[model samples]
Target: MTYYLGIDGGGTKTYALLTDDCGNVLGKGVGGNGNHQIDHALAAQSIRKAAEGALNEAGLRIHEISHTFFGLAGADREADYRILHPLVQDIGFTRNYSIDCDTMIGLRAGTNRPYGVALICGTGTNAAGRNPAGQHVQVGGFNYMYGDFGGGGSLNIEVFRSVIRSWDGREQTTLLTPLLLNFLGYDSVRDMFDDFQDHGKHVPVHAAKLLFEAAAEDDAVALEILNRQGVELGKSASAVIHKLGMEEDRFDVVLAGSLLTRGDRGWIRNMVEQTVAAVAPNAAIVTLATEPVVGALWSAMDADGHAVSQDVYDKMRVFRNFEHIKHQQDKRL
Candidate 1:
């Protein structure tokens, strides 16, 4: 009769799942942006809203939940914990709850093995790893400024960089300039730049999809961009694998985030696989097919010395369209 709560607090939307001791998900809820870096107070409200919805649907109260686990964006560093701990406490968990960066849950979500590497390349890039010894490590930046690569944000920035470079004659002409112009319905680059400047708008993250289109047309520039992205992703994963001394270990390389999950093993994913193979030949690549909150819940179960089965994972399929949620929900208005 004991119930557990698991939350995935992300930049786009927050998801909460409620389940019993047996790992059968009873209820799930969706809420707003839960990245505390955007606005901690508001983000806390989002988490609370999601948790409440899940609890309500299950006809259970917070008091009845035995444990709560939060895998949250912006829970990256000690400073983040200082800010997030108070917020999580404010959301009604006075004690007996656990918190970690969302990447940890993504790692657990992708594989049944307890130890492996995780490479995330969706809106942003992050790398993490765990070993059989229970040791864990996270490498690279939480944002592009930290030299992170291979995510939609960095890819979007690169596309514009190529456009500006080609326009100024610093680089050869690229399809990105014309493709972006047509995509945005602009006649010229000047108009596109002007419109963005006037509105203080940057390229949207989803625009990264253009790389695939350009590559499909055999655009050299786009192909190069994607290839480099894949290599960088592999290098990041390699670093974590070495740090965890897992290079010789046979483990799963969990690929999550929109960039790798979508498409048919595009340039980036292929290059990543090649690079990881050079470093960790024993590693097998796999995509995360479930919502990451499943990992948050499974991690809690693991902590309590319970073995998670494939049947549990099969119940954790993403219930909603993730890309659609990222694009349409939790606008920062």
Candidate 2:
């Protein structure tokens, strides 16, 4: 029984799935932060731990696996490749593995087609485009230094800045002022700003939801922040589409990440949909409908030259999440 391994390594957690030739999951495992950009040692340990746990559960040795594909965050540049190449190779698969940006996994997971654009609107913004000829191009996700913006994290800080701007008389008072103060239980903007100053500059990523709440109440400031963010995300996607010469191509602009999947339909998400439609007239926007790691599995199968069938995807859908997958081990067991 040939086995395949798929791993999605991200900053928050690492998840790995082991499957048989038919895409029937054998076992799944998870571990800690796996973004090598944060800590190479931690990422390496996380990947190994997750992969080993899955292998142990499936009672299979690394040698028994036919192929492995790792979709990893923080794999944006050549330096990242240098770090990840040796890191994954240390897993001892005899080189039967493939490495690509984690966004590619989102791309594959959200769309049935092999080629299209993947837009990530999470803690940070990033995008990747795949053309029919198998060419790949990535833009943004390099942080502010690289002109990246329009993710949940970006929204979080921008909200605070908006509050500061209102206080400085640069902008009119916004619902965000009261909404944020109430949400965090701060007595006033001055107190909140002082606390942020003394504690740390970083705002909690969850605070980004406040923007949507304020926008829902018809707050102009909140709406502006959201519009700018949506435009930024759309701009990133548009850049990728044009670079790949897929502007006129009919394809799915797969949307993944916390913000787009759950945020306001009339704002950020709608803006992305509109942007894709204007640039790529035939491009349709769709939220990721499967566990992202399933894309990792599909990528592995594709990289190994195996045909990916509807049945294969159907079998993998059983992988909803790490917890869900663990609860439903193979019935044959």
Candidate 3:
């Protein structure tokens, strides 16, 4: 039986899925950082290792694979392809290969139909939509500096601003400032200032965790930040919806990203629900808790023009359920 391979290459982790021609996933593997900015050679090595590991776990050799699909960060540009293609080709699978950005795969993953929208909020943010006619439109994927609002980095930056304002006695004290200091591993606000000067790293992506923590404690600043975040994300989603002329179309708005998948997705979900309900009342809201590698695999099948049969969807759903169970058990343990 011919097997297909699918990979989801992200900033923090690379996931690989091995599946048969019929799209039943056999086994999976994971690897180190695959963000294009973080050492392409090492990232590619990690990807290749993960792919090989998945093949081994599946009890299949690379020679038996018919197609491979890689959905990755920074794969949108020719330069990125220049850096990544050689490394992927080095794997020597060679029957057929396709590559695209993570959002493209995400849009394809949710349904067999051609029209839908996807909003990704992770270490960064992006939005994309595909109409039934195969026409597409995207908004706000410029890069971290110009865009990427409603993401970890954005949340962290807001926390930092709140902390600084509290230090200056300019704003009402909240639970966030204390938590921010703890997160920075500093004894005082002055220490945070000094650390930022020394490290020169402007924003702290990890500090976004404090937003959820503060929200849990009912901090006003945290709530406001999260609300604004929701509004911003809503605006982005609205832009994509308008671009598709899908205001009246019944389609699914698939929330695909680390931010949306996690338990902390509450605030964003609230925003999405409120905004979309008012504007695109007919649109369905769904969260893709499945790892994007599964989405990438579904995308590969779609790209190959393979009919997504009930058997394939059922098998994938089973794997997703198994994964969810394992995740819950791990959390309990």
Candidate 4:
């Protein structure tokens, strides 16, 4: 009756899943943002809340869990680990746990093989890959100032800058100008620019949806932005493949994150697929066939020396798809 915990702590939300040694899910809970880079207090709060909720739903106490795996955002450096490791430990609920970047879980979500690549592009972008020889390499995840781009935040900033340029007559007129103005409740682009500059007003993350909507309408500017982002994501994956010496080796490249998983827009995914195929013709692109948290569960089982069967993996996949459908339906309501 050993229970394990798996957590996927991301920029926008955190998810926790409780499972038995046989991979049967006992309970699932979700909570607020857990990106340590944004706010440490909030991240810790989210991690605790989600984990507690899952434990309660499973009718179990935290001390009963045998092992826990946390895949968290902003855990790229040793400093980050220093901040997160103790925070998770302070929960005082689990006997053993491990923490790593969220990308690791995304990688595990795609393949059971020991070697492959993962690219995440949601609130931020990052790339990680492992070679068959156990060597690992990573790219991006340095934040915007460090030349990182091609995530929701980057896309929003670019669209905002484009609106400012359009207002200043520095760039061609774009549908984004009016769309953003309306979305922001501004009567004029000048007022919006003034508010942004003088008042520090920021565009919402959901503004990314507008960009994709415009692109779907064949807006040249919006399409170009998405195209560039897709290429950038592809190049990041390509860099990881080259570093891992998997250029000719067939491997799985898992694609996850809000922007890449957007149901209506296949252009971004297509661009990435085309770009990667040009370099690594044999690489298989996996579109998050299961939730990343499931990977955490698999890792947890592996750590505890439990046998994981293909039947269990299939069951996890089915459970994830059901959860996804339920989430979408709830959103509509």
Q: What is the C-alpha lDDT profile of model 2 across 235-307, one tens digit per residue?
A: 8889999999998788888887767767766688778777777889988888876667789888888888888
TM-score of 3: 0.87
lDDT of 4 at 103: 90
lDDT of 1 by residue, 76-106 (tens): 7999999988898887887768898888888
Worst 10-residue stretch by lDDT in candidate 1?
Answer: 317-326
Query: Which residue pairs come into collision in candidate 2?
Result: none
Show model 1 residue runs off by greater than 4 Å.
Answer: 182-185, 317-333
lDDT per model vs. reference = 0.81, 0.83, 0.76, 0.83
Comparing 1 and 2 on lDDT, the stronger one: 2
- In the predicted model 4, the residue pairs found to clash are none
Pick by TM-score: 2 or 4, better one:
4
Q: Give the TM-score of each candidate.
A: 0.88, 0.88, 0.87, 0.92
Model 3 Cα lDDT, one tens digit per residue, 221-323: 8888877777777788888888778888888888877767774647767887788878788888877756678777877676676666878876774455334
RMSD of 3: 3.5
- The clash count of every prediction, one per candidate, is 0, 0, 0, 0
What is the Å distance of residue 162 in model 4 from its true position?
1.6
Candidate with the greatest lDDT versus the true structure: 2
